[model samples]
Target: MIVLLNLGFTITSTSQAADKIAIVDISSIFQQLPQRETVAKKLEDEFKKRATELQSMERDLKIKMQQLQLNGSNMEPDARISLEKSLIAQRDNLSTKAHAFEQDNRRRQTEERDKILNCIQEAVRIVATKKNYDIVINANAIAYANNAKDITNDVLKQVK
Candidate 1:
């Protein structure tokens, strides 16, 4: 019984000595960063022209489609066939452009997100080092963390 008591004491002391835990909400940090807004603005400005052009093309495609549908029954066979072919070609072009725009937008967003993530990591590292944190975990993975142990605000301040 004495040996078992000693073992329990040792385990408890070891755990106490090793408990230097902190939690941060990385998503909250990311969203709270001013850099996120800058990146979003840059992406919007970069893609604005292409997005506008795509919109214009879509409008044109819609108008042409309506015209075809409305006039198809009254038009001569050859004329109707020609107009249909033109509409098909325009639709294909619009589809291709729209797909390319979407891909480019996604890539740019991913790049910006990565850059912000790197910044957040650096901020966390700085805060952790300064506060002498032995282990910092994302709060998202924890069911509950004491507000005292949550360093998200500290990390955000450092990041900002």
Candidate 2:
């Protein structure tokens, strides 16, 4: 019985050892990727001019509001009313432009993120297949894993 038990335990341990598992820190991989920075720069360059224009428009609106507050009481009623209407129109236009800018920025960010994620996924697949990893899991989803099982650096090298 003792011999049988030892044989059984040995087989179980050997089988478990053969069931390979790998862990990867995908967020870290994304951050470490050179493509991430290149994408960020591209997005920034695409939107910088519009962002600057929006800021200038915001500043101009604030100044107009301040001017109206200071001089409304001294101005003729018709002029005050016209100036108020102008400010309202300017504010509305600025609001619309700002909202559009935010939406566009979000869309661009999503696009860049998707592109990076696709690259990471491809890298993971290549490494997993090449290394014969039975399973590869995101490090964030796992409670604990041995460093020996980590393939993040391998994936990062592929990404770079």
Best by lDDT: 2
In order, how many clashes per candidate? Answer: 0, 0
Q: How much RMSD separates candidate 2 from the native structure?
A: 2.7
Cα lDDT tens digits, model 2, 36-139, are 88888999999999999999999999999999999989999999999999999999999999999999999999988998999999999999999998789999
TM-score of every prediction relative to native: 0.89, 0.87
Local error of candidate 2 at residue 13 (angstroms): 7.6
lDDT of 1: 0.89
Worst ten in a row by lDDT for model 2: 13-22
| Candidate 1 lDDT, 1-160, residue by residue in tens | 9999999999998676446678889999898888888999999999999999999999998998898899999999999999999989999999999999999999999998998888889988898898888888998887875543788999999888
Model 1's TM-score against the true structure: 0.89
Which runs in model 1 stand beyond 4 Å of their true positions?
Answer: 1-18, 146-148
RMSD of each: 2.0, 2.7
